[model samples]
Target: MLIQILLILGFVLVFAITWRRFGQNVITFREASLWSFLWLSGVAFTLYPGLTERLASFFGVGRGVDLILYLAVAIQFFLIFKLFILNEQSERKITNLVEREALSHLNEDEPASANRPSNYESNG
Candidate 1:
């Protein structure tokens, strides 16, 4: 059907983007592989939606759509959690670097300032 064809195309597009990201070093090999697998799985499920129904039934869910929605939400939450952790780590690193550089600059300027006459001292 037209819908299946469109779904397949969309999945292919996702796979292409994942591959491009991996090639460009924007994502690691493990990340690309996981995403590629997910896209391929999407294509497979779209091609045979009955599988989702069967899985849903096996898991005691009333409908395949519901199961998919639940899974998508859970995945979204996990990804958000991971991004939060990474963001926190990045902020800590930036703060530490800024503090270290400030201390180093202060240390380098101390001896020079010690030998320099202050404007008030010079005027007096």
Candidate 2:
């Protein structure tokens, strides 16, 4: 249980920092909120195995614990998928930005000074 708390806290801290940094153009608030929910839910589910088992049985799962864990895994996977999508979006944006910059540099005239070696080159 303690371990779960620490892990959850760690994830939340990292998420907060990442969300703040990438939140600008990376993910919408709604998406982030859902992402957070999925992660936190998994953490909560993992920590309370007994409760999860009971809930699972209540829902017709033969083994409540196993069912709960499986559900948690599924939920976690979904969140990870969403996170990956956001990550891909950011990566593509970066790729596009870099490509645009490179193209612009290619299209524009080079600075006149860059075309020739400096006077120091002759001295060497």
Pairing residues by index, what is the TM-score of model 1?
Answer: 0.78
Q: Give the poorly placed runs of model 2, Cα more than 4 Å off.
A: 1-54, 109-124
lDDT of each: 0.87, 0.72
Residue 97 error for model 2, in Å? 1.2
Highest lDDT model number:
1
- Alpha-carbon shift of residue 108 in model 1 (angstroms): 7.5
Candidate 2 structure quality by residue, lDDT tens digits, 69-114: 6787997898899999999999999988887677555525657666
- List the RMSD of every prediction in angstroms: 8.4, 11.3
- The superposed Cα distance between candidate 1 and the true structure at residue 24, in angstroms, equals 2.7
- Global lDDT of model 1: 0.87
